[model samples]
Target: MRSFCLLAFVVALLLPTQSFAANRDQHIIVVSVDGLAAYLLNDPKAPLPTIRKLAKAGSVAEGGMKVSNPSVTWPNHSSVITGVRPEKHGVLANGVLVRGAIDVPTVVDPKRDQQDLIRVKTIIDAAHEVGLATAEINWPCMRGSKSLDDSFPDVPEQVIHMTPRLRQELVIDGILADETQPSFAANSVVGKDLIWTEAACHLIRQRKPNLLFVHLLNCDATHHLLGAQTPAGYTANAYADSCVAKMVAATKEAGIFDKTTFIILADHGFTSTPKAICPNVLLRQNELLTVTAGKMSDAKIHVFPEGGIGLVYCTNPATAAADREKFRDLMKDKEGVAEVIFPDRFTELGIPHPREYNQSPDAVLVAKDGYAVAGTPIGEEFVVANTESKTALGSHGFISSLDKMNAPLVLSGNGVRTGETLKSVENIDVAPTIAKLLGIEFPSADGKALNAALSK
Candidate 1:
């Protein structure tokens, strides 16, 4: 009787040990560099020691990947986590119409704890179903998210929309939730927030979540404030690199470094521009805009008389081919206009042209690299002149330029092939690959599984 009882105890211990090891294999950590470029690792001029080490330690892609349209922060980051496009994910833009007013919310909504905003299942959600723990820091589309067992959340700062100092403190107010807070870059030296590394370390040591996601937004803020090439932008990137290194070291110290897999990715890259163009000015100048509306926020540019949606706002679908030619000629003639794509061409570019539901805009005008669309209000036939904002040195949102599409994706750690370069892949592929890695499923995702980068 004593021998049988001892045997049973030994079996119970062995069974749980095997199960815990298997769960460790299934866990992963995803980190976002915000605007990390694949070249950053290869660039001798830039010193990203930690990233270089991670690349050396595991598999790394030569170039990054991105989603279809509005290749901005919210859309791309959401895709990274959920593996769904903006069209499918329902996070069409950074801001969505909360009420009748165009009161769109940024990724950092004050009401993120609600959890109903998410339309798709994230990698974490899939993990949680199998009894895995999840955590996130500054990941977008996280409001009303149920995927996390613990999350720092991609919330906006209180006080001002961009001012996150107060909000950061508030997030860490509770015991279980107060593991770590993000280290934000400060305008002044006196008010410096700790780096992301410190916060990530705290989470690892305190909560020790299974799947962790983090975003470092200093690069995006730098790009918005200064052009990519400026001294300030360069400095900001270096600072971000330092923060990344700290997080990597912390993971190592936690003794989970070798057991963990790290995926370092970015939302989009940056480019410098000399000027910004607003095609709405031309439409208003030509009296091409017809106003029977109070205000037009979802603006599109139409080509001519209107065969299909040429641009977003100028919706003259019945326009003749000759007029379409004229609009194309006008867009081409513009100095800053990069390329003018007709509806058919737009569809080929992966964007469904706005039709009855504004699917087909008349003609889509791509701004030259380094230029962006001016956020001008539309009323009757009118052009809101663009005030030169410090020469518009750094900007994105162009299809013709590679900067808009190119982003970095680094896969490392367990179950990832070390030093492998996937020459070609898309942003949509990330979700499916993560699903397979964790033994989850997302049948609705259009992205195919990148099985080559994974290990058996």
Candidate 2:
């Protein structure tokens, strides 16, 4: 009996420990520069000193590719953190789909899911599971993330909350003092650059989370307001890059510089399209879209009325099949329309196409590189006036060259190989690499560990 008891105790001691562990003392900071291109790092013309330095010292993906459809902020951002596609994570677009279960339309309510509601283990969650702390500063869809040690949900104030006059009064009170600087008052967490810098710096100085995620949208906002190649867009890009430099400095000042691994990435690239194609106008010509007072608030347009698998959804499902056929035939008739995809083709490209929900648009249309589609009807051929407007400067949401696929993944510091490059990799691979760095289990992750690039 004594021998058996001793043997049992020895076996128990030899068993593997049941918790994830931080593989290194160095921290991992994931930064997203909205609409940033991979070339930004190597572009000497762009004055991004800190980013260029990191690129030179770290391993970088040739260019970061993104997921398809809605291809907007929330889904792609969620994909990098969660290691899943939009379909799997359920963030279809910047806007949420409303099936009329509630009295009001449901936007992407960040508060719906509690922390543990995330089924897939995020890099942060994996870090935490293995006993490493985490933090996020202004990353999208993070309003309800319970795993974060510190977070500020991107809540905007409405006219109902405070009038312009009242807003000034509140600003004087410093009730809305910027988190970074604590001196200025700004409307959104983003514009208060000094505040975010201060807040992130403070977190790094004090708590020192194992994984930190920061997203700065000022650049993308600038691009949306200015064209991609325009001076305004370039200036915004420079400003965003400077903010990144500040972050790198902060980590170093905190004395975690050597141990921390920093990664700079972008969600998607921007494009310049100056025309809007109104498919609804064509539907009107066919008597499919009935306009009341020349306003269309409730009616849906069969954007790709002729595609085999559809992209858009309308209240009237009965007309979809015939309408899809019509839209496809019309595009076929048009000279410049590049590609028209039905719902079926989206899946073939490895893009998620949900069959159970009406999340996708009607038939999808792809215009040439210089062309853009508008919500309103103009003519068979039309140009968006004021194409030079700030809002007309740059845009995205199309299928084209890798220039739109441009983004970067630069990893540096402890546990990561210095001065390396990941030849060709997918965005899905980020989660697993972080998991390996933190020594956590991400069993369901589709990406590899990228062990070849990092220290074992």
Candidate 3:
């Protein structure tokens, strides 16, 4: 009998852990507050009562979450949802980088569908595959997704781009005057955020989706316009808190608060910059690119700006080697230039190789902390002052390794460990963690489920 008991215990240990078992009835709401730095939670003056309460009740990444390279919105958000970096997910920027002819300038087009942007299976797709209902509001790379039961995509002309049913419901509920472009465009940034919050609450009460994703943009915009740690930035953070409170209230009203889990996080953090570095201006001055009518007509090289990082593309393949060498010489002693990252470093940084991906840049130019990358070939000056009245005072999209790029992450409610503090986490880990909470399989994810943060 003792031997049999021991055998049974060993078998149980070999079996799957209960902490990772599927919970089909469980609901998870992922809220991405753009530009909400991890440090803000520890700030005494920051207004984040609701988020702090959630952290106190559940697990928190005290050291913050490391984001993907470039540290931009679309790439990091895709990492959070797909459990992979930009290289695997195929999202190098906020949109698809369309490569034209050898002499033609490439463009980042944001009108592409979700199917065209994301290469990997998302957590939402996994949940929907197993008969789980899902919804997303203002979530990036979710435009025209069939997996979502309801969606208001974060794209140009959002109201018109939203699912037909969602548009009709919003109109019927008096949240929108009509589905016209002009009507939706009339609302201010804050007003649009309120609409999104209301839509989220309505979905919680009505559809009760098994998984829901919400993204708030006010803090990010505020940071860009007024800079981080400013009074306006605090107000924007407070407003985001209010939005979360409303969603929490909706969950309680729907009688699912006890069974629901809330994962609040951000894509990347923000930093203030005193100067903007225009590498394209330098290229034009060197005659590497030609400007016509204040716009780049043709180029041997072009630099695509991603906030504090610039993607240097050799538009002319024939002169690629020479152009790169020339670019290095010109930028070697340039102020505000931090590092010139080549293809050799792509693998380590989770960036795609130029040979494998057409959108990949030949070289990456990272800016110093107090400078931002700008793509303006027509500008006479290579470096210009960043002012509130002209350019944005703050920006992100630095290399993810920078400490200032760390974002916040808090997991609360059902299936989560209580009063736990994690030293650090990765944005890629979020998807698998959410999948484990729902008891779903996400085998293709590059990141493992954060078991320590889950309750037994």
Candidate 4:
């Protein structure tokens, strides 16, 4: 009897693992259209035929997806893949916020790799662990991720940062001049988007990774240059739609369109702000900050602007309490100051405490509608009119609870509920939903799988 039991155990061990191989045939592609607000879908003037078709053919989040606090590109994108907010994922900005010495100004450095920015395991990591192929194109905070089988990261020198295989392939296909090619610069934003689209399509056709992520940036750039809901924004949306169509075509050409699922969504929405609120000027006037030689030399406090919000950092811990109170008093009756969020409310707002994460701010300043935050410390006036050459006409990075920051969501293709409209969803739920569709285990995710949108 002992010999028979030993033989059975050996047989079981020799067989393939059922759990990891269950959904080997499934493919999931997540595409993020930058600056695609939920309201744009209902706008009569917004040109989005491809996106509209996807909505009609599959499940739609009518109320849109609520993003994490500090609704910027990198943090929300991290939440989309990790199924957690900034408090858990630890990405406070578009990159790593380096807390320098008390005498130096805190800086947001974007040159860091994935391991430096993200604290939690991503969906790509889970998939790769189970022997599934994964790829990311123009995805931020993924500069040097070994989990991805193929990667074309979004950084300063994109062409140089691509994985060795991807760079070689692009060069062989005549898409790029060489491995040392400096930039992907094009005549217009639309032209630059086309290059990224072409690279993504090529990746899909050749690699056919089980999991893929693609980010398009034309709409976001256009919205910043011209206000949202304007004619220029509409044109940019139309260009993004065409890029989506090309990706869909690539899937079809690869013969995986029937077996593939596409999650088309945006990181956050845009808001128009005609005026700029310079909270750093207030700190400068109170002698909390000092500038010398055209640069900040000695600073007791600093305000880092993130579009519609400003992150207040106190350089000295001993004076943090007193400094917060003093700044609150300074901006008591300011024109564009909306609310001063102190450290006590950080937990409720899904932000980490400064003691826990270096990127966490001592306080957060919210801007009122029609106003955006600026980091100019030496401006004579605290609030100034936004000019086309100086400031962005449209911005995001506001509190996620604001209705104007709601992002659009659409799920289509295999394993999706057809023609269903969801009232609302959160961006953190995306990773778990993808895991469920792929028959993978993502037990550490904070958000639950969106079972309502899945057909099983």
Please state the error at residue 106 of candidate 3 in Å: 1.1
In model 3, which regions exceed 4 Å deviation?
Answer: 1-22, 388-390
In terms of TM-score, which candidate is stronger, 1 or 3? Answer: 3
TM-score of 3: 0.94
Instruction: Give me the candidate number with maximum lDDT.
Output: 3
Deviation in Å, model 3, residue 264 alpha carbon: 0.2
Worst 10 residues of 4 by lDDT: 180-189
Instruction: Put the candidates in TM-score order, highest first.
Output: 4, 3, 2, 1
Reference-based TM-score of each model: 0.73, 0.81, 0.94, 0.95
Each model's lDDT comes to 0.57, 0.60, 0.88, 0.87
lDDT of 1 at 149: 60
Better of 3 and 4 by TM-score: 4
Candidate that scores best on TM-score:
4
How far off is model 2, as Cα RMSD?
5.9
Q: What is every candidate's alpha-carbon RMSD to the true fold?
A: 7.7, 5.9, 5.3, 2.1
Residue pairs whose backbone atoms clash in candidate 3:
22-439
Ranking by lDDT: 3, 4, 2, 1
What tens-digit string does per-residue lDDT give for candidate 1 at 1-456? 999999999988765332343354555677787765544555575666766777787776665665445566666776776676655554434534132212111122234432444457666676676666677766776754656665555655311222243245444642223323333322232122233445566676665667888788766666656655557766666776677676677777777776677777877776655544555456545654433353333322332111011134343345434455666776766666566776666545554444522323345666655455553334322222233522234554445137444777778777788768786677778877776676656566778877778885
2 or 4, which is superior by lDDT?
A: 4
